[model samples]
Structure formats: structure tokens, C-alpha cells
Target: PPDDWREACLSNDLPEAGTLAVTLDEQVFCLYRVEGATYATADRCSHGRGSLSEGILEAHTIECPFHQGCFDIRTGAPTALPCNRPVKTYATREADGVVWLNTSPRDVAGQP
Candidate 1:
């Protein structure tokens, strides 16, 4: 396991193509499963206080229930109106039936 990785939950705990919210070290994160792959991001929507875990999951995107804004689950990039700022993302993976979440921010364009 990576030094910053922490066990989040069992892989089977997540519904297929859905979202789950988990708290680590007092921070909330939304976990997602899409096409057998897992992803993680800050649970709060960048545009509002809406909880991403309660929002709609569509393919690789999550739609904020507050304003109907959408974000790409893979990169946390906003993909719809009312959500221009990118949400914080974390590196996530599934191994041995367990889902692990990296405490460090996900690297994007060589930036973290």
C-alpha cells in the first residue's frame, strides 16, 4: 500500500455505478464506482454546500442535487453550469475486495 493510502471501505459496500460518502480524519469524501472502477472526491460541491454523495451519479459525472450542476467524477472538473470551480479529488483504488483512498490530492497535469 502507498504511504498515504488508507482503507476506505469494502468494494462490495458500494453500489454499482453509484456514490458513497466516507469521512477520514474529519474530512468528508464522496466515493464513486463506475464501470467497475472506483474514484474519490471532496464530498462538498465546489459551487455550493450540497453533498456530492446525495447527488445523482451518471456514468463518470455527478450532478449536484442543489443546483443540478455536474462534475466529472474522474477529475473533479465541473461539467455543467453553476459549477465552475473544480472539486478536490483523491486517488482511489480497489484491491483485495477493499477500497483504498489516498490522502494526497490527485495529480492533474503534473500538479497536485
Candidate 2:
């Protein structure tokens, strides 16, 4: 693993089209597996205190459990009502059966 990346979980632990909630350095994050890629975002819903990892995952969107507000898992964009603010998105990658996350927020182009 690279120095800037932190292992979040074993790749097998998060199957395809699944969500995983993880905490590192006292911060919570939600990891998702869509298609064959992995993505990470703030676990808390921007519109409420609901845990996004517990929400439903539809295509590339994650619906908040509290208000049913939806957010794009890839870009963290608000896609539904009651969620006007965007959640912070982190960089993620999977290798050697381990899921790694770059806690630092990445740019829209996916560059850190």
C-alpha cells in the first residue's frame, strides 16, 4: 500500500453493490462498491444526522436513512429533495483484496 492510503477493509468484506461503514481517526466514512470500483464518502448525511451507510444504494446514489435524501456516491452531489448540500467524497481503491481510502478529499477529476 502507498503511504497516503489507509486500508479500510478487506475487499471481500464489501461485495459488489454493497456498502460498508468504517471509522478512522475518529471520523466516520461510508465505503461503497459499485460495478467494479470502490468509492468513499462522509457517512453522515449533509441534510441530517442520519448514517448514510445504513441507507439504500441505488445505482450510483445513496439515499439517507433519515430524510430519504439522495446523493451521488461517485461525486457526492445532492440528487434528491431535502439534501441541498453535498457530502465530502474521498478517494478509494481496491488492491490485493484490501480496500484503501484516501481520507483527503479529491478533486472532481479524482485527483488528490
Candidate 3:
């Protein structure tokens, strides 16, 4: 569960054309502040086990640094071929000047 969950950034902490990786609750979350609100997903690419934190973000998608795989930031669904596996994603919400991620108390692979 999210205990006393607090702020992640001041919205501008991450650029609109890039991403930011932050460790929260022992898990790595890759935050994409694209366009307006922020989006978050597990920092690992499910397909080749690539570190998504090291990938290049394209709009609402992330290109895996290891295998050039692409996944949607909003749903963590693989958008490119050779990487159909979906990564764990978290719910995002913005309050004040900060962004918050909700890592539900469920397995990432079995997330609803």
C-alpha cells in the first residue's frame, strides 16, 4: 500500500520531451511529464528486461534502451513489435506542484 505517499516532483522537474527516473518504495518508476500531466511506469522493459529509465521517450511512448522496444506511457503497453510484453504501470495524479504515483498493492504482472 502507499504509505503517507508524498510529492514526486514540481511538475517541471521532468521535461515535456524527456523522462525522469525516481526510486520510490524500493521500486524504480519512470515518470514521463509529456504534454500536460505526468505519466509513470515501471523502469524495466518487460520484453528484453531493458532499463526503461535509460530509454528515449517519444511523445507518450518509451523506446527501450536495450532492444529499441516501444511502450505507451499511459498504459505501459508495448507499441512496437518484438516487444509485446506490457510493463507495470502506476496511476498518476497531480496536486499542488507535485506529481504522485500510486503503486497498487497488487503484483505488477497482475495489475488491473
Candidate 4:
């Protein structure tokens, strides 16, 4: 059975408009708490495999630390230059002050 997902976060842990790095079953993803809901995406950037967890967040996108590539928080689409490759994104939501992620297998992760 899959994990409840929300168990990944403890009470009063997530920060508003902040990013959180989480590992689910060995898979690493950057969890972003935007507005109030939670969004998950691959922590590695499409350009040079940079650590996106350290990237900057603007509205609903994040800027890659390697080459300033921008990506959407919901779909993980390339939103800026220096990168055009799409990254994997997972389904996420928040409940009871904790964030939940659906780390299920993807056919072609991040694509609509």
C-alpha cells in the first residue's frame, strides 16, 4: 500500500511560501508550499542537474540555481531560459497543517 503521504510532514513544520526537500521511497522531490496548497517536483534542474531545492520561488515558479532556469510549481514546465527540458512533478495537497504527496509511478512524469 502507498503511504498516506501527509505523514512526511510533522505538525507546524511547513513554512509559507517556502520550499521543503523530501524523500519518498528513495525518490527525492522539492516540496513547495505556495499560497496554502503543497506542490511537488523534482529537486534537480533540467539544466546541468542543479539542485532546485535551493532555487528561488516566484509566484508559482522556481528559478534554477545553475542557470537561472524557471519552472512552474504545478506542472514543472520550463518557464525561463537556460533550460527547456521538463521535470517530473508529483500530485500534492495539504491537510491539517501537513502536506501530502502522491508518489505513484508516472508514465512520462510532469507531462499533462
Candidate 5:
């Protein structure tokens, strides 16, 4: 962790093309590893109460478990319907083999 960022998980903990659920200060987030890069977003689907961590990962998209909707893991944009709204996205980085999240909106580099 550094400054405003919080430690989420070890970089190695998330398998290749895998997703992991993490909670920080009561807020739930999903960590993803794809194509050798890591991404972070809210664990809950924007369209419903779907748990994204339990959802399927296809390329850069995460399919909502409840409604089968999909969202881009990197930008949090809804890529498939039944989900028109976007999930909150966070900036992520890997340091010392650990995944770190910049939960602050201002610090986040990704879009909603």
C-alpha cells in the first residue's frame, strides 16, 4: 500500500484471467488479472445485486451472476444488457508482488 491506496491482494493470488473478491472498509470490490494486467471494480453489478466475483470472466468482461449482464472489468462499462448502468471503477497497481487499489475517485484512472 502507498499513500491513499490500500492493499487488496497478492499479484500471484489472482490466477491468469481470474477474478477475486475483496472488501475494504465495508466496500466490496473485484480484482481481475487479464493479459498480464490487473483491474479493479465494484463487486456488485450495477443493474442488479449480482456478485461480480462469482460471475464469469470472458476476455475483459465480467458476466453478472444474477442477470447474466456483462461489464468491462477495466472501465466498468456495461457491455451487455440488462445492465445499462456502469459499476464504479478503481485504479490498480502491482507493487512488491501485491495488488494495490486507489479507491478514491480522484485517484482512479478508469472511467465509470
Candidate 6:
């Protein structure tokens, strides 16, 4: 395992093609599983500060429930109106039936 990778949840804990909210080191993260791949991003929407985990997940995008803003789950890029700022994204992977998250957040340029 990578030094920065910390266990977030068990693989079975996430529903297929769904989203889950997880807290690590007092920071909230939104976890998503789509097409057998997992992704992680800051749980809060940059624009409305809404919980992204409580929003709707569609393909590689998540729509903020509060203001209907959308963001690309992979890069945290805002994809719709009312959300011009990118949310933070974390590196994630699944191994040994567990989902691991890198505590360090990706840069605003979307580099991990």
C-alpha cells in the first residue's frame, strides 16, 4: 500500500453505480463506484457547499442537489452552472476488497 493511502471502506459497503459519503481524518469525501471503478472527491460542492454524496450521480458526473450544479467526478471539474470552481479530488483505489483513499487532495489543476 502507498504511504498516503488509508482505508476508507469495504468494497461491499458501496452499492454498484452509486455513491457513499465517507469521513477520514475529520475530512469528508464522496465515494462513487461506476462500471466497476471507484472515484473519490470532496463531499462539499464548491458553489453551494452542498453534500455531493447526497446529490445525484450520473456516469462520471455528480449533480449538486442544492443548486443543480454538476461536476466531473474524475477531475472535480465543474460541468454546469452555479459551479465555476472545481471541488477537490483525492486519489482512490480498490484492493483486497477495501477502498483506499490518498489523504492528500489533488491540485486545482487536477493533478494528484
TM-score versus the correct structure, for each prediction: 0.93, 0.92, 0.82, 0.83, 0.90, 0.93
Candidate 2 residue pairs in clash (backbone atoms < 3 Å)? none
Structural RMSD, model 5: 2.4
Overlapping backbone residue pairs in candidate 6 total 0
Index of the highest-lDDT prediction: 6
lDDT of each: 0.89, 0.89, 0.77, 0.76, 0.86, 0.92
Model 2, span 3-111: residue lDDT tens:
6578899999898889999998678999999988999999999997999999999889999999999999988889999999889899988889999998887776545
Cα lDDT of candidate 4 equals: 0.76
Q: Report residue 94 deviation for candidate 4 (angstroms).
A: 2.1
Stretches of model 6 off by over 4 angstroms after superposition: none
Q: Which pairs clash in model 6? A: none
- Write one digit per residue (lDDT tens) for candidate 4, span 1-112: 2564545564256677888788877877888877767778888887887888898988798998888989987777898998888778877766676667777533354542
Worst 10 residues of 1 by lDDT: 103-112
Ranking by lDDT: 6, 2, 1, 5, 3, 4
TM-score of 2: 0.92
TM-score of 4: 0.83
> Candidate 1 on 8-71: residue-level lDDT in tens?
8999899799899999878899999998988899999999899999999999999999999999
TM-score winner: 6
Q: lDDT tens digits, residues 55-92, model 3? A: 99878888998889899887777899778878877777
Candidate 5 C-alpha error for residue 96, in Å: 1.3
The candidate with the higher TM-score, 4 or 5, is 5
RMSD over all Cα atoms, model 6: 1.5
Q: Considering lDDT, which of the candidate structures 4 and 5 is the better prediction for this target? A: 5
Candidate 5: worst-modelled 10 consecutive residues by lDDT: 103-112
